[model samples]
Target: MEHDYYKEYYELERNHWWFVAREGILSNYIHRLIEQGKLSSKDLKILNVGCGPGRSSEYLSKFGKVTSIEYDEFCCEFASKKTGLEIINGSITELPFEDNSFDLVCAFDVVEHVEDDQLAVKELKRVTKKGAFVLITVPAFMDLWSHHDVINHHFKRYKIKEVNLLFDTINDGNKVFDTYFNSLLFLPIYFFRKVSNFLKLGQKRKGSGSDFEAFKPGVLNRILYKIMYFESSVINRKIRFPFGVSILYNWKKF
Candidate 1:
């Protein structure tokens, strides 16, 4: 990620439809776990892997103490100043922590950035305490790949089955929740990306842009947020979606 991109992210992450809605969805899941007595909201040792820009660490702070790590030194500095929390500089494939360190581990949209995603998953599981939880989100479907992925330096997008296999290979955890989110906008986003790719839109600029750059705050943003928030409400009711723009999964370490 470039410095310019990080600057844009710091500005938009607070209210962008994609960031805000995804946070809402994940918060719902965490709240559900608390409600079910599966998790406690106080005194938890939480590890936020790949804590880009630090908003996630700030948000996760509500549940308990949050220790954040980011691969980029710039992101570490940017996030620490923004949130006033000390952000550790580190990599997902080689987390600098002892085994069974945290009660909750979050790696939202982080694994896709790693070339050795399996090693990344292993590291996530390694630092998690036995009986603790790990939550992850990743872009779904290679078919939906676009300039957004390229600009973000993603190694690959994921399918539900691929995610399942990624976790199953470790064999140290049980999957508690798994669902495809952003389902409502999947078709619209799919078509837009497809059409955009067909016309070679933004291909000339390549690394110079991303989907985040397309966001404009207004009625459309609010509407998209509301749509995804409603979808999250449905998901909290234990309804599973077959497919969508992204995948969110929860795993409990054994």
Candidate 2:
């Protein structure tokens, strides 16, 4: 990301509806794992791969100990200050951890940035304990690609078929359990981005979101959150949506 956009992200993450809704989705998954005895918050050792400013890492801390890795020094510094957790300056393409180092590994919106996503997935599996879960989230659909992707240095957006194919190649023997989310508002967002792309409207025409400002009522924010939260509730019940703005997966290492 451009230098200023990182600042924008840091400032907005705490209050943005998008960020809050994303956390709500992940939080539901974590809590369910606890309920099913698949994960124990107190004993888990977690690796937060490519955590942007460690926001997700900080959230994961409530579930277990979290160690973060990011390739950028700026992100490492910001995340360190925000979470005060150990932040390693590293890349997902080659995580600097020994085999089976963590009980849980999370790579959210991170793989798309890597040049070799397959290798990155392999590293995620390599670092995780056998039968441990790795949660991944990435932007969905190549058709949705625009300057937002270019500005963020994303290599590829994903489709459900291709994403599962990557996992199967390096399966290590576990099945892929996954879903598409950010569903209800996908059409509006898609059209908005399309128009924005056609007009090339962005922060200083840089194809970034930093200069974009949003003002909404507290009620509005809450309503949006609730709508998304309801979709997450559907996800929690183990039903996967057929299409959405993003894709999420939970693959257990074997």
Candidate 3:
């Protein structure tokens, strides 16, 4: 990822509709697990892999102890300062931790950035205790690939089956919940990306910016956040959408 993009991301993550809504969705899932007696908030040990600017790590801290790791040194420093947590400089494919270490592990929008995504997933599972939860989120569909993916240095988007297959590699892992989210705006986002590609916008500029750069906080932002937040409520009921802009998977190592 470009340096400037990281700076932009740090600034926008707090209030951006995408970040805010995504966090809400993830939080809903965690809260649901606690409600089901599958997880306990007290004394939970969480490993937040690829914790970019540490917002998610900070949020995860509310549940229990959070160990954050980031590949970029700059992001490690930035996140450490922002969250006041000791951020480890590390790679997901080669996590610096003992086997079966964490009660809960998360790698949101991280695996796609790795060239060897399988190794990343394996490492994630390796450090997670038996019967512990692993939560992952990734961009959905190769067809949805756009400047947003490119600027973010993504390897590829995923189909539901593909994501399932990735987790299936771990014989001991059972998928407890999975869904495609950001569904409400998929059509509009797809159309916008198509039009932007046709216009050759940002095509010539590699390492320029991301889709988030175009977003400005306003009524529309608030509306989108509310829409996704409602979608999250449906997801908490284990209701699944047929398709969406991103995929979320919740797995338990057994």
Candidate 2, 125-203: lDDT as tens digits: 8899987888899999988887777778889999888888778895385654688999997887789778877877654
**Lowest lDDT block of 10, candidate 3:** 200-209
Q: Which candidate order results from sorting by lDDT in descending order?
A: 1, 3, 2
Residue 80 in model 2: lDDT: 80
Model 2 scores a C-alpha lDDT of 0.81
Q: Which tens-of-lDDT digit does each residue in 1-254 have in candidate 1?
A: 88767767886788889999998898888989999989876799999998898888888888889999999998888778877989999999999999999999999999999999999999999999999999999999999999888888999999888988888985699899899999999999999899877876756554356776565799999998898888888889989899999999899999
The all-Cα superposition gives candidate 3 an RMSD in Å to the true structure of 1.6
RMSD of 2: 2.1
C-alpha lDDT (0 to 100) for residue 226 of candidate 3:
91
Error at 207, model 3, angstroms: 8.9
lDDT against the true structure, each candidate? 0.89, 0.81, 0.88
Cα-based lDDT at residue 33, candidate 3: 94
Cα deviation in Å at residue 169, candidate 3?
A: 1.7
Q: TM-score for model 3? A: 0.96
Residue 228 in candidate 2 has what lDDT?
A: 74
The model with the greater lDDT, 1 or 3, is 1
Error of 3 at 174 (Å): 0.9
TM-score of each: 0.96, 0.92, 0.96
